[model samples]
Target: MRVRPFAVALMTAALTPATLMSCKPSSPPADGAQPPAADAGPSSTQTDTAFAALSKRFLDEGLALNPVSATQIGEHRHDSEIDDLSEAGRNKAIAWNKAMLAELGKLDIQALSRENQVDALIMRNNLEGSLWDSETMQSWAWDPQVYSGLAGGAIYNLMAREFAPMPERLKSATARMEKLPALLAQARENLDPARVPKTHAETVAKQNKGVLSLIDTFITPNAGQLTGEDRKRMDAAIETTRKAVEEHQQWLDGTLVPNAKGEFRIGAERYDQKLKFSLNSSLSRAEIKQRAEAELKRVREEMYKVAQTVLKDKPGAPELPDAPTPDQQQKAIEAALELAYADKPGREEVVDFAKHTLDVATKFTHEKDLVTVPDDPVKIILMPEFQRGVSVAYCDSPGPLDKGLDTYYAISPIPEDWTDTQVYSFLREYNKRLIHVLTIHEAMPGHYLEGVHSSKFPSTLRAVLRSGVFAEGWAVYTERMMADAGYMDNDPLFRLMQLKFYARAVANAILDQGLHVDNWTKEQAMDLMVKQTFQQEREAEGKWVRAQLSSGQLATYFVGAQEHFDTRKAWEAKLGDKFDLKQYHDKVLSYGAPPVRFVRQLMLQEPIQ
Candidate 1:
C-alpha cells in the first residue's frame, strides 16, 4: 500500500502474524470489538494526561529500538544508527514492549477522551502485536527478507529524502553505512538456513546486491558534496559497505538459497493469526473467503453486462446472451477486455502514460468535487530496484513527520531481459484504462491524497501507526467510486477495467488464503488469476510470487474496501438526505489512517476501545 522505505515492507514481511492476547493492561479489546461506554468509568482529565504521556514515551522508546523505522517515520535523531538484529537486541525490544504494555495497563480507558481511547487501544495492539510476533511467531529465525529490508533501509532512508541538508544527510549515511556490515553479520547469525523459505532466500539473494546499487545511486553521487575528512570517511565507509554487501550476497546464494527448505506457506493457524493482526477487523478467514467469492461472482456478472456493450455486434464476438452460461460469460468478458488491452501504452510509455492519467484523474476529482485534492507534490518515478519483483507500483508518501515533501508514485519499469512477448503481456495487463484506475488508486484521490489528509491531523502517534487496511481499502474503493461517477466520460472500457481491478482485489483475498491455508498449487493460482480475474500472464505470474512472499497483505484491499463501503453506507443510512459525499470523505480521512472499524465507530459516536 505504502512503500516509502523498503524497511517497513521487510519488517512487516517478517513479523506479519500478530495475535492480541490479554495483556497486563486492562485488556484492550481486539479490533472491532465493543468497548465499555464512554461514561461508565470514573471521569477524569488526569487519566487522559497520563495515557498521552505514556503514548509519547512508548513511541520515543520504540523508535530508539528500531532506528530504521524511526528514519522512515521522519525521526532523524537515529539516522546514523541501524537496528540491532542480534538476539540480545531482539530480547531487549521484547522487554521494552512488555514494560510498555504494563504501563498501558495502568490507564483507565473510559476516563480518557474518546480520541485518546482510540490511541490507547492502537498502542496496546501495537505493543501486544510486537510481542506476539517476536515471542509467538518467532519470524526472526526464519525470514531473511526482514533483515534485507533493514540492511538496505539504513542508508536508503537518509538518501531518499531531503529532510536534512545534503552534507548532514551524507554524514548520517556514512555512519549508517559503517554500521551496516555488523547488521548484515547479525542477520547471517540470526537466520536459520533450514528455516528460510526458498522463495524468500532467492528474492533476497537478488535484492541483497541492490544495496550496493543504492549506494551507487544515492550515496556515490553525493560523496563529492562533502570535503576533507568527512568525504574521506564517507569514501572509506562506502568501500567497506560494498565489500560487506558482496560477502552477504555470496552467503545468500551459496548458503541461504541452497539450504532454504522452509515452507513459504505459513499454514492455517499462522495465517488466521496474521489476518487478525494485519487486518485488525472482525472478518475471519471464512467470512473473507465467503464475501470474496460472492463479490467475485457479482462483479463478473456486472462485467458481462459491460462486455455486451463493448462487444455488441463486433465481428468474432462471443455470444452475449442475457442469461449467459459460465463459458459464454467468460468468453464475453475476455473478448471485451481484449478491446481495452488493444489501447495499452508501449513498454517505454507506461510511466509517461501514468503521469498523464494522474493529471486527468486530479482534474476530474476537482471538477466533480470529489474529496478535496491536496496540492502536495507527487512525482511518478521508477520503482527502486530493491523493491521491484513485488507489486507493479506503490505510493511512497513522505513520512508523516516530514511535512511538505514529495510523494513518489513509483512504477516498476519493464525488465530489460524480458522478451517482447513478456513486455507486451505486461503492457496489456496495465493498459490505458487500467492505468487510469491505478492513478486513481495510487495518486490522485487514493494514497497520496489520503496521506496528505492523514498528516494534517496533529497526532504524531496516529500517523506513526497508520493502518494498511484503511489506506489500501480507500484506494480500491476509489477506483469503483470514480468509475460509477462517470470518470473518463462514462467510458464502459474504463468501468470494465475498474471492475477487473476490483475483481483482482477480491481474488487477492481468495488467492492469499488459498495459497497459505488451503494448499493451493501454482496451477490453481494461475487459473484464478488468469482465467477468473482476467489478468495478463505476466501479472498473474508476478502475483503468484507476491502471494508466496507475503501473506495477509494481498487481502487488505478487499477487506479494507468492504469496511469502507459499510462505513459509508452506515453514515448514509444515519444522515439520510443530509449525507454529502465530499463531506463524508473529508471527515473519514480526517481521523488519520486508523482501521476502518475504528474510523466508523468514531464517526458514528460508537464507543471506541
Candidate 2:
C-alpha cells in the first residue's frame, strides 16, 4: 500500500515538467501524447537492447529500495522483513536514481515503442527532478516520520483486503508488527531533528499524538477477541507498540520540534528544480502558474454562475467576496452555508446519507456506460480514528498492487458535543458541495476506476510515473463529466454543486503553488477558495491546511482532469467519429495513471521506455 512507483515529493503534479520529460517535443499543430523527438540520439537497434535492459534494472532497483512496497503489493518476495530506515537506506536510493538516470541517457528513447519510450521518458523525469527532492529539496526535512501508510499497510497485509488469504496475511503482519519498533527506532535515528520543517513538524507531532489514540480506541477494547495464547501475546505486543509510538511522539515534540531548523518553505530554486523533474509536463513552472491563474479567473466567474443557479431563490446568497479580500468572503461564505443545509437532519442522518450515497453511486457505474464497472463492490467504510483531522471523508481504494478488497468511501462521524447550529452549518457545507463531488471522484469512474487501471498498467515505470496530476485530475474531470452525462438526472442543483467542486480544484492549484512557493497569506488562500471556488468558509479553512500539509498536490485534480479531457478530445477528434465514451475511457485508463504526456503516447500506441 505504501509502494510508490515514483518517489514524488507529494503527488505527481508537484513534479517539474522538464524534470519529468527528457526527450523534448516541439509543439504539434494538434496536440497528442507523443512529445517532439529528441535530436536523433541513436539508431533504434542499438537503443532498444539497452532500453529493455534499463527497464528491468530500474524495476529491480525500485523494489530493493522499497521492500515494504513489495510486501504490500502481495509480491511477498520479502514479507518477512521491513525496510532499513537508516541514512544508508536513504543514500542508497539517491545513488540508485543517479545511476538509473545515467543508464537511461545511454539509450535513445525515440528508438523504443511509444509505450516503452514514454516509460523511458518517465524514468528520466523520475530520476532527474525526483532525485533533487530525495537528495536536497528535503520535504522529509519538514516531516520525516509520516509512516502511517506503513502502519496502514500492515493492517492491509493482515486483513484479506488484497489477494492474500487470512492466515498468510495475518502471519506476515504479526511478524512485521513484531519488528515494527526496530523500524521506528531506525526512523527516529535517521530522521534529523535539525532539518525538520516547522509546520510539518507540528502536524506530525499532532498526528503522532493520535498514535496512542489508536490503541485506546481500537486495540484495547478488541484484544480479547484474539485466539488463546495468541491473544495474550498479541495484546502485549500492541501495548508495547503503542508505548513505542507514544515515546517517539514525545521525542518529536520534546526533542525535534524545539530544534527542527530547516526552512519551512522550499526556496524558489529548489522548488523550480523539483517541479521540473517531478511533473514531466510540457509546460514550465511559470507557464503552469500562468495557466492556473487564468483558470482561477475563469473558474471564479463559472462559480458565481453555478451559485446563482443553486441560490437564485435565496436572498443575500449571491454575495461572494473577492479572492484578494479574504475576510468579507469568509463571512459571506459562512452565511451561504447556513442557508444551504438549513434543513439538515441529525448527525446520524448525515452519516447514514453518506452510506446510502455510496450504495446509490456505485450502482450507477455498473448500470451506465459511464465506464466499465468493477465486479468487486466498492466498500464505504468508517474512517479510522487516527486519520480524522485531515478530512472528514476520503475514498481509499485497494492498493493498485493489491486486488479483491472493496474500495472504502470512508466518512468520519461528526463530534457528539456540537450544538445543533454548528452541526447544521458543517453538514450544509458538505451535503451540497463536498459529498457528491467526493463520491464521483473517489468511487464511480474516478479513483476506483483509476485504481483498477493502475494495477493493470504494463510497466512498473508507468506505475511509478503515476501522477496525482493525473489521478485527482481524472476524478475532478469526472465531476464535470458525470454532470454532463446527466448524473442525478435533471437536478441542476447537484450540477451546480459539481461546478463548485471543480472551482475547488482550480483554486486548490492556485492555493498550493501560490501559498508555498509565493508565501501567500491565509487570507489570500481562504479568499481564493471561497470567492473563486464557491467553497464555504469551513471548507476553505480545511483545504488551506491540507495544501500546507501537502504541498504540490492540490494542482493534481485540476491539471490532471484537464489533461485527461484534452487528450481524449484530441484522440476523438483525430479518431473522427470512431470515438465512444466507453472506448475512450478504456483506452485512456488502460495504461494506468501516468502523467498525461505518457498516457497520450500509450493510448496512441507509442512507446514509453
Candidate 3:
C-alpha cells in the first residue's frame, strides 16, 4: 500500500498438478482399503470468478488502508485521508497483509486463467513483500525519509493532479495538512536514533524542510478560491503545517544528525530478500552479480572501441593497439567523451533542451512506427524542490486510474549553491546527446508511452502492483532500441552515448551489491563510476549518496534490461519473419508493467511460472 514513487530509472517455485480420479468404494475383501475419492475442485470459470472477486476485494481493502496510495493511483475515494504511521497503524497494515495472503492461499492456482494466475502471483508477492518490509526490513524505524516522504506526499498528491476541482483538492490538502504535525510526531517516535543511518537522517532533514516549499509552491496558490471560513481554516492549516515541518527539520538537524549511528548496509541476507521481492525474477543474487560483472566488462570494451573511433584523429591520441593498456583505453575514452561534453546546454537552457529533444524523439517514434504514442499529453517541468537530491530527472506519470491528466517529465535544475566545477561536471554528463537519451528513456517511448499503455490495461491489481523491473527495464531498453533504429541519424556519437548510459546501468548493479553487500568504500564506488563507467565526479558523488540511501533498486536497470532483451531474443527466434516491433511492443505493454518473465509468459502463451 506504499505510494511508490514514479521516478525514472528506477522469485520462483515449481508446482505439480494432481490428477483427480473417481474411485468406487471397495469392499473390505478388496485387494486394499478403498482410497477416498479425489475432489476435482472448482471449474476454471468458477476459480476465475472467485479470483476476480478476491482481487477486487484486495484492491479495495488495500486502498482503504493506504489512502496515500489511493491518491497516488488516482483513486479519489480516500484522497482526503492521511496514513497512520503510529504503531497501531503499522500493526493494522501487517494484519491486513496476513489476511489477504491467507485469502490468496485458498485460491487454486491451476484452475485460474493464465492472466488470473499472474494476478494471483502479483497479489501474493505484493502482500508478502509488504509484510516483509514492515516486519523484517523495518524502514519506518531506521529511515527518516519514509516519514518525511509520506508527510510531503500527503499534500503533494492531492495538489499535483487535477482529479478534482482546485477548491476540492485544496480542501483535501488542508485536511491532510492539518494532520501533518501528528504525522511528524509519529515519525519522531517511530525512528530509533540508534538504528537511523546517517545519510537517511541527513537527507530527511533537508527533505523535511523542503516540504514547506511544496506547500508554498503547490498549495498556497490555490487557496484563494476558498470562501471565508474555508480560507481561514486553510490558512491556519498551512501555517500549522509550516511550523510543524520547521520543527521537524530542527529536530532532524539538532537531534537525529548528532545521534544517527546505524549502518547503511542492510547486509547480504536482507539484500537478497528485498531484491527477490523487488525484481520478482528467477535470477539469483550471485547470478545477477555475475551477469552484471560480465556486462560491465563488455560495455567498457565497447566504449573503448568507440573512443578509438572518436580520438583516431585527435592530437596526442593513443595508438590503436590490438590490446591497449588500461591507461591508454581510459585516456582515449575521456578524450572522446570530451567532444560530447563540449556541446552541453547552459544551465538556464537545460529544461528547454529536454523539451526540444522530447519533440524530436516523439516525431521519430511516430515516423518509424515504434510503439503507439499515447494521445495523453506529457509536460516537461522543473523538478519540485522536495523531490531533488534523489536523481536528476524522473517521469511522473499520472495515476493509471486517472484519465486525461498530464504526465510530468520533471528535470531537476542545478542547485544555486553548487560550485562551478560541480555544475560543469553535471552539465557535461548530461550533455546534448545524453539529454536526448534521457528524453527517450523518461518520455517518448519510455515511461510516458509505457505508462499510457499501462493505464489502459484492464486489471486494477496489475496496474497497482506495477513491476519496477519492467518499467525501468523498458525505459533502458528503449534507449538502445532508438539508437539501433537510426535515431539521431544513427550517429555513432549518439550510439556511443547510449552505450555509456548502458554502462552506467551495468555499474548501478555493481555499485548496489558492492556498497551494501561487500562494504565498499565511497572511493571504490566512485572509481567504478568515474573510471570504469566514465561518469562525472559530481555524478559519482551523487550516486554514492544514492547508493547508500537505497539498495536492491539500482540493480533493476541492468537486471531488467537483460530480461527484456532475453525475452525479445526468444520472441524473435520463435516468430522469425512474423516478428514485428510494433506488435511485440504493444503486446508486451498491454499486460501492464508486470515483470518481464510474466510478460514473456503472457506474450508466448506459455505456462505461467
Alpha-carbon local distance difference test for all models: 0.80, 0.60, 0.76
Please report, as a residue range, the 10-residue window in candidate 1 with the lowest summed lDDT: 19-28
lDDT tens digits, residues 209-278, model 3? 7678887888877778998989999999989988888888888889999999999998999999888777
Estimate, for each residue in 1-609, the C-alpha lDDT of model 2 and write its tens digit: 111333532212222322111011112111122232344344654565567666666655565565565544334655655655456766776777777877777776667656557666676766666567666765433455445445444444444344554445444555666767876676576567777766666766776645445445544555555577666666667767777777777887788778777655665676566556555555566766787788766654554444444555676564553342444444444444445456453577655766666776677665677777766665667777555534457766543334344556677777666678767667776774457666777767777666665556445445444565666677778788877777787565566567666777777767767776898888887768776566667777777766666655556566677777778887887789777887788777776566776677666655453
On lDDT, the candidate that comes out on top is 1
lDDT by residue for model 1 (398-485), tens: 6665655676889876676778887777778888998889889987788878877765555556666777788888889999888877
| TM-score: the better of candidates 1 and 3 | 1
lDDT measured at residue 528 in model 3 versus the true structure, 0 to 100: 97
Badly placed stretches (over 4 Å) of model 3 are 1-42, 375-377, 380-393, 411-422
Go through the candidates in order and give the C-alpha RMSD of each one to the true structure. 5.1, 6.9, 9.5
Model 3 lDDT on a 0 to 1 scale: 0.76
Worst 10 residues of 3 by lDDT: 11-20
Model with the higher TM-score, candidate 1 or 2: 1
